[model samples]
Target: MTGDERTTTVGQLPTPDRDRARLPATLTRVVWLLWALSLVVLGLRWWRGEGWELAGVVAVDGLTVVLWAAVTFFGGIVHSYARRYMAGSETIDRFFGRVFAFTLVVLVLVAAESLVLFWLAWLAMGLLMADLIGHVEGWPQARAAGALARRHFLASSALLGVALATLWWETGATTVSGVAATVDGASPLVVLVAAGALVVAAMVQSALLPFHTWLLSSMTAPTPASALMHAGFVNAGGILLVRFAPVVTVEPAVMLAVVLVGAASALGGKLLKTVQTDIKGTLGCSTVGQMGFMLMQAGLGFFAAAITHLILHGFYKAYQFLSSGSRVEHTAPNGTSDGGTTGPVGGAVVVLTAIAGGALFAALTGKGTALDTGLLLAGLVVLTVMHAAREVVRQSDVPAAVRYGAVPLVALPAIAVYATVYGAIEGLLVGLPAVDEHAALTPVHALVGVAFLLTYLAVDTGVYRRSRRLYVALLNAGQPARETLLTDTEDYNEY
Candidate 1:
């Protein structure tokens, strides 16, 4: 069947054979249902303070159960969404099968106690996602995207393999739990090298900074595939780090380096997002920034917070990708936004609300403005609340009093909900050690913070718009590979 002969005329995605769709849809739905039921069972066990292990093969505890619940829940949501979204696609079953396989692999990854099993599951996930990335097999752009992603994923796998192999060699531990127990006995040099490999592997998988092109170029994936990849797959990095927190935190310098790398990626991702012209590209950049921030939290000795960050991020990104189509209709004419002005009264309200939000966060989460990473976390909470307050005040049409009142009403509740979730996640992740570490504030942190703030201010104030060289550089960096570009419809039609 040719592209022009298909029934789906709604978007750029290919159409399916209607008759064949039901089989895959039904099979996927069945699996999703079973997966969801398993989550319930796991939750019950967790509530009862029970855990399980399979004699050094697999384990189900706080970390495993939480990740299982998260991945399967997202998988179920994607499967349900795709049943309708992919109804008329020819390879609907194939897509569903691959997605089903990927979800299972992730479940295994989270549960695997054996290092070899965990590594294999991790490797298989990338291969499955690469296949999904090129689900539109006839499209050369899609094929190129899949190939690029495959290469990056392969490299990520190789790094992870090397890290795990080194740990096994040094610690003589065949299982991840065993490695953690004996990792300290390994030489410092060996541990440092292995930890570095793990960080690189995670960065590649999460599409952080220099490794981000693969994800950005993967726009050719079906929307459902994109949603699953962004929601669940990219989150593996944070999970990897969290699971191996013992190795990562062996040296304070290594953790500091993670913070530096994460901060750089976070800043870079946000900057690059501003120059993206496409919706998927922009969202890809946003994922990079979010993943970077998650890693930063991990580096700060907040593994539980990192897990919470990824779980919430998965929910948010999945919705964004699935509903990206609606964004077109709602887009303002000529790309204009509601950017009126703010008055002095509204400005004062912003400052007050931000402070209150910060206080509320500290009180609720037990992370106050101390001489540690808690200060950084508190500052982020303040900025988030301030941004929320700013948006409310930006509504020029609303009365000053209403806008002022609405700021706290919106921001406080959000802060409260987030703090509550953070606490719950911390409790659920108690089985894993090193979930929360407070790094003492250093001069380097202060310097980096100042630089990040200045860069943010410059970008927000449109200072970069005047710099042609910087803008062009960023634009080029933000673009997908040349082979992945679909300049004309004929490119796909040629197949």
Candidate 2:
């Protein structure tokens, strides 16, 4: 069979011959049209140099337009892909409806001028997602996943409501922009409490640590839903932080808490990803790790970098999920490998090259305050170390010298793209409220950096690989429901 035929046949359930596949195609076209219209509207608004503002209750700026554009762009792509991938499914129309609705809700949330609208949109999105997750009503796993997601989302919404209420009570600002503008004048105690609540809300929404099971369980949903959820909704937490950057950046305690939680989630998610046996599970774990990284960027006061990362990762993950069915066709038919390994010396060379490339890019950007600079430098070191390790694993057969040379060639271009995107976002958000003061890096930041480096080294060096028990535990840490979800029972019993 041809590659396309093979992909279409794999893991696909048999559908009735009379299935109305054209419904999904039509839905896809509608979604694309809506996306195009949004672009036109946003562009005209930008051209006129006027944003919609409703008595400090609602506002839209360049940043809002940019974020809305991204959501629509990705949402359209996913809709188009799903039109084919889910063509024969019985509930294709329902799937398309939910996806389109969720996309619209996200657009509203991103452009919401007031805190009340943003919170309502946030809650609505979560409920819509849960409905989508339970689209296959007869499937027990889908029901369980939906239930888990609803519970977490409810808690997240409550926390976010409290945070918003506090901001309003203290600043008498009903709009996000208004709240941000008045944050500096609020009492320190009020700011800290509100920021803490917001961070916790973000953590829950992003599925950090204890709240991550929903993401994994959610793989039981249709592929299109999974793609959209991970690619878009999962990053809402980062968006939340960026939206409230003025407050989050000023509260050092809140920032420290964010960094700590983000670091833990990143490490745990990465470790879990290594042990996943299924593609969806692996992708789910990866989303958690990426969310953690995004939150860490926000914690370090790299608001622009966090936004850039969110946008890029959304596109990358959407592609990953939509094309996941082609994995079988792309794999080596014989399943054999050269089994080459990069020794310590080669690994060191790759790491050094990556670090140098990252440092050079950081210097070129020349943005951020001194504290931001230090935090960026520290983050770059960790990023490069991880990047080099990945490169080493992928190209284990290459000579050390050639690999070392290639590392810069690859790393530098990626860094450049990141910096360019970050700069653009910074420019767009320049008029928005942001913390401008630079504070010296505290010992906690230093310790977090050290811990990340050491953990990476240990994982790369096979410390966990050497311990079978540890490896197994890490692999199954948050996967207790995996067996229940994957089992092939025909009964409609709820899990």
Candidate 3:
């Protein structure tokens, strides 16, 4: 067939038709307004130190306000985008309904003061998202992905329920705030077991490490659904940690475990991210890595930093997924340089810039509220420096002076934004319950920080560029399970 004929045939396949998307589009706008008003009311109540209580079981606080605002805002944006993105899809209305219902559940989960309500909302949110994942009903891939998600979510819900039940039994408190208040006096063994269960639940919900396949498989779903999954629901783990910070922080062993797990998952996800060929796969892995970092921050007793990271990452991921349809042309092919550096000099520049920027940040932020926070700040500095360096390197033909000058111009705003957001979170969450007191820098924390920084720098500098086998393995890691399932299904169908 001629190119024109093929193009016409392809164009006739289901394409977005905005005219038919009116219901979802209108609902999106109305929901956005309602949530905005809810956020304002919640914020005012928090300001007045009279947080609104519902049914004597739910209460809204700063954390609730911030998280609910994120869900509503991003939820609206995703819906609006989906109105066009999923316009011609047969199940577009179902998609919108599921997303709206999921958002509502998440808002309730975050704002729920009662432990029972929180757990129920959490489960409902998961099921709703799973429905969203399988919205393209006839697609086997969607079904498989949704099934995987449901399995993991069900496990998470079970574990969370056990943890909450344990907490209630031990503390005689059924409210989140009440349980947190009673954590200090609870039996050590009970707290430890409950904390461990909660950690596992968070790990599953956040798609950390071995439990991450659901997220990868979920790319088969529509882009809007993928966006919501990554940007909104994936944050549950971080929120869980933040909510129970006081209790978890007190358990040194649990905190240590959290740190180790988070570090492992962060590194694993990042490495796997480097190898993905597809855009959605890469973004999914990126979310996994970002979740690891956020959890790591929480583990390190930087609850405020964790919250900031969660909120910002949510916004960033939503934007990425929404704009991904337009980014196909910009995606770099595998094994190609997208202006990143591999040379020794480039590596040196990256290290030096990281140190200088980290020092400046530490100075401005007063050593960052905790040792881990300082390390996180340093790591972010490295990332910012590397980004700026890549920009300069990519513009190699530009005047040397211009390139050097652009570094500061680029780095300054990033630093400023980081400092501003970190400061704001610290201020906003000051009165939040369950926050552990920030510990001073310790020898162990320092070592972990240094080790993480070195490892990250090595990876960033392309030390693995020559390891083609490893690269290929990492790139294809996400496909095996789905491929196997699909193959088996096809074989069965043929028989």
- Give lDDT per model, in order: 0.85, 0.77, 0.76
Better of 1 and 2 by TM-score: 1
Q: In model 2, which runs have C-alpha deviations exceeding 4 angstroms?
A: 1-23, 37-50, 328-339, 367-378, 385-405, 435-439, 480-484, 489-495
Off by over 4 Å in 1: 1-19, 330-337, 397-399, 489-495
Best by lDDT: 1
Cα-lDDT of candidate 2: 0.77
Residue-by-residue lDDT tens digits, candidate 2, 357-438: 6565667566422454455444654465555556554575676677666666766777777778777677666666673333
| C-alpha RMSD of each candidate structure in angstroms | 3.0, 5.2, 4.6
lDDT of 1: 0.85
Query: Which predicted model would earn the best TM-score?
Result: 1
State the lDDT of candidate 1 residue by residue for 1-495, as single tens digits: 245655443456555565677677676677678677778867786688868889889988788888887888888889888888877666778888899888889989999999999999999999999999999866878999999999999999999999999999899999888988898789999999999999999999999988999999999898999999999999889999998988999888888888888888888888899898778889999999889888888887878778888989999999999999888765457976656566788789988999999999999988865667787777767866776688789887888788888888889998898899899888877767555655667776777677666766676557878999989998998888999987866554553
In model 3, which runs have C-alpha deviations exceeding 4 angstroms? 1-22, 42-50, 330-336, 340-352, 369-380, 391-399, 439-444, 483-495
Candidates sorted on lDDT, descending: 1, 2, 3
Candidate 3 similarity to native, TM-score: 0.88
